[model samples]
Target: MEIFWRIFDTLILAGGFVYIFIRYGIPFFDNRKKGIELSLKKAAEYEKEAEKLYEQAMDVLKEVKSEVENIKKEALKETETERNNIIKDAETAAEKISGNYINQAKSEIDKQKKQLFDEALNMSFKFMQDIMQREMTSEVYGKINDSFLKLQEEAFDRRSNK
Candidate 1:
């Protein structure tokens, strides 16, 4: 009789515990599982979105890099062009300066030649006067004076015509 009562009490207790677990624990665990599944879904969506953003950023980076390279090349070309222009301008200026110097030198040479010719003419005239004073008579002097006057008039007329 004691064993039978003990077995009956144990069965009753076990049945109540099972009924309570089925009524409450299973639903709670199911709801918890649903929440965990929803969290996993959201994490997957976020991962996909992050990958898309990364790809877009990479594309943008590529374009920016290409643009930077193009800008660098254009700047180098402009710099080279400007350098060439400067060299050409410098060469032109040097040529102009040299041309001016050559013209000035030619003019100086012509002026010096005119001055030397004038000096020689004056020296010859003075030498002729000294010789005439030392060696010539009055009649010879008169004749020489007449011829000299005629030569002087002819020279003056030719100079005026030129």
Candidate 2:
């Protein structure tokens, strides 16, 4: 009777376990597996999206770097142009100043030459007037008349000797 009771109890416990597994455990496990699979799919999609975003960011960074290099080159070119323009302007200004200085010096030299000529002319005129006045005096005239008389006497003497 004891062994019969043990077997009977064991059968009842096994039947209850089977019933519970069929009623709730099967549905619960199936839903959990589907949820895990959906999560895995979502994770794969997110990884692909993240990879595309990273590639796009790298491309944009490269474009930005290229733009920055272009800007730097342009700035250097403009700076060089400005430097050349400044040098040209300075050279032009220096040439103009030099030309003006030369012109002014030439003009001054001409003016001084004219002034010296006029002063010399005035002195010459004054000397000529003084000498003419002295020559017009009676003493200088008598001297000139004596020189001509001597010349005539020498000429007559030379003719008589010949």
Output the number of the TM-score-best candidate: 1
lDDT of 2 by residue, 37-154 (tens): 9999999999999999999999999999999999999999999999999999999999999999999999999999999999999999999999888778888789989999999999
lDDT of 2 at 33: 93
What tens-digit string does per-residue lDDT give for candidate 1 at 27-77?
989999999999999999999999999999999999999999999999999
Q: Candidate 2, clashing residue pairs?
A: none
**TM-score against native, each model:** 0.62, 0.54
Q: After superposition, how far is residue 162 of candidate 1 from its true place, in Å?
A: 27
Model 2 alpha-carbon miss at residue 84, Å: 0.9
26 Cα displacement, candidate 2 (Å): 8.7
Candidate 1 residues lying further than 4 Å off, grouped into runs, are 1-36, 139-162
C-alpha lDDT score of every prediction, in listed order: 0.95, 0.95
